[model samples]
Target: MPPVTERTSSLELPCQDGCVNVSIVVPIFNEEGNVGEFVECVFAALTPTSRAFELIVVDDGSRDASGEMLLRLAAERPWLRPVRLVRNYGQSSALQAGFDRVRGRYVVTLDGDMQNDPFDIPAMLDRLDSDAGIDVISGWREHRQDKALSRRLPSYIANALISRVTGVQLNDYGCALKAYRREVIDRIRLYGELHRFIPSLARDVGARIAEMPVRHHARTHGVSKYGIDRTFRVVLDLMLIVFFMRYRQRPLHAFGGLGLWLAALGVAILSWLGLLKLLGEHIAGRPLLTVGVLLLVVGVQLVVAGLVGELLSRIYHEGRGGAQYHVRDTRN
Candidate 1:
């Protein structure tokens, strides 16, 4: 294998001629120990399916031998295409880079770690291909192999919260072994930690989603890159998903609702204080009066902020020629 910088900078692999059936995208981040075994398993599993497939391995600025290994693998195998990002921009960004470059009818995503089985890819692809109505098939790690307290518990809580908030219930939001139709996958863009909410975002765009049980294996490689610290980021992304799902087109409605409630409360407080003063009570220097005034000011500020949000949302859509609604089919 060549040096990481030289290989990554010069390597460029293109999809083979003819239509591609499936593009398997795996985002690797410092998974040098597992690269060889992972690729071997993936090839062994997909080869039997006899599908015109391409393997897109995104080397997310691994500070190890991972990039070099991928370059060597790509050099020998025409199916393996290595995409090296300039630096580590997290898993979501790496996945986005792969997704942007895929040229297949079906796009599948799985983790680089050996924990997620590559064999699940075939069944997921089959499910999507069998039903035109099913645009996305998510993997459910029914019997997760991770620690119950540290990973499984928080995942369960977060999955439940996401199901309720997005109304697109799935057993596992953290599973990376998922399959999606090319059109469905291309309809949405990813940012931050939004990759976990792909199904939810797809649902927002009228995608039909389903879940199936997939095999999971315990890690036997380099240290796990993820931890409980990601929970905070997941929660924040979930909130963004909820907002985008419901109020992405009408930003004013979400902000205005809270603004109205706060303004109403503030007005009620001030009215009560004014009535007390009119009834011969000395309300000067009262804490309630100060709080009421503060609330009124904050309420007005919130309303102004809501207006600004509406303007920004308008600019976001119109400036970029984006549409809030997508049409499924039309006949004259």
Candidate 2:
């Protein structure tokens, strides 16, 4: 066959119709047994598409044969891009690596375990096709196949809390399958659990978001990884995301909001006490007075905290980096 022409831009290929460009990003942790079938299924799903596409598989230091399988597939298929991490970095890092490597105008991310249906890829693409302005098409799993306690319950609670906090009403946040427009992919910064918040982050940066119900299949290989501990982690991340989304741009706003509430209540209490004293009211040991003083002091402290947060943010942008979650271990 002809020598494969290589493209260098971030979006190396755009679809012929200029409709919806596509990239299939698969993050493989340790699913050694499923690699072959997964690739075959992905290619099969894309076989009839008229649009241009590429498959990027990130090997997160898989201790099993996943790395070798990806390497072998990469040699056979020009569209197959294989990335290897230095160690077991986890799924978020793997997905980010794929995102960094994808050159298609629209990037679609799916798990390597073969749980998320590649057949649904075109559904998301179709949604994007109908409306080009949409920045991301999130896959909503209406029929989840994982265990009720392990996956469904935790996911429901987390998704609900995240939606309420981020103000992005996508029904599913933890669904590993989603499609991102090239511009949307370019603008958002990816980190730790922020991958789950991509839709919200994109919206924060003025990108349109949409969601669709996608086909969810039961896992074909390996054991499920969800647990109660991870559930707590999800909640914790949600709270942090709430703070980041609401106050990241204006640290003063977040801290100051609380401060203002406290200060107002404190002032009201003191004002009432002062009016009582002026009227010859012997209200010396009123609990409101003590509470008011305490609230005032705390309010001042909160304002100071905002100032510190602002300075820290400035310093972060100046040279030093911002907060990063360091991974101590992963199961790949």
lDDT of 2 by residue, 1-332 (tens): 11222323323333333443577888887888888777777766765566677888898888888898888876656667788898987677777888876677888998878778888887788778789678788888888878657677778888888888778897888898998777677666677867778788778767778888888878868867666577688778778777887778579888977998998888888888899999999777888889989998888888889999988888886667643332223996
lDDT of 1 by residue, 43-157 (tens): 7676667677888999989999999999988786777889998899888888899999888899999988888998788888888878988999999998888964778777877
Best by TM-score: 1
**Alpha-carbon RMSD, each predicted model:** 5.0, 9.0
TM-score of each: 0.90, 0.78
Strongest candidate by lDDT: 1
Q: Tell me the number of clashing residue pairs for each predicted model.
A: 0, 0
Q: Which stretches of candidate 1 lie over 4 Å from their true place?
A: 1-14, 278-280
User: Where does the lowest 10-residue lDDT sum fall in candidate 1?
Assistant: 1-10
Question: Which ranges of candidate 2 are over 4 A from the true structure?
Answer: 1-20, 260-297, 312-332
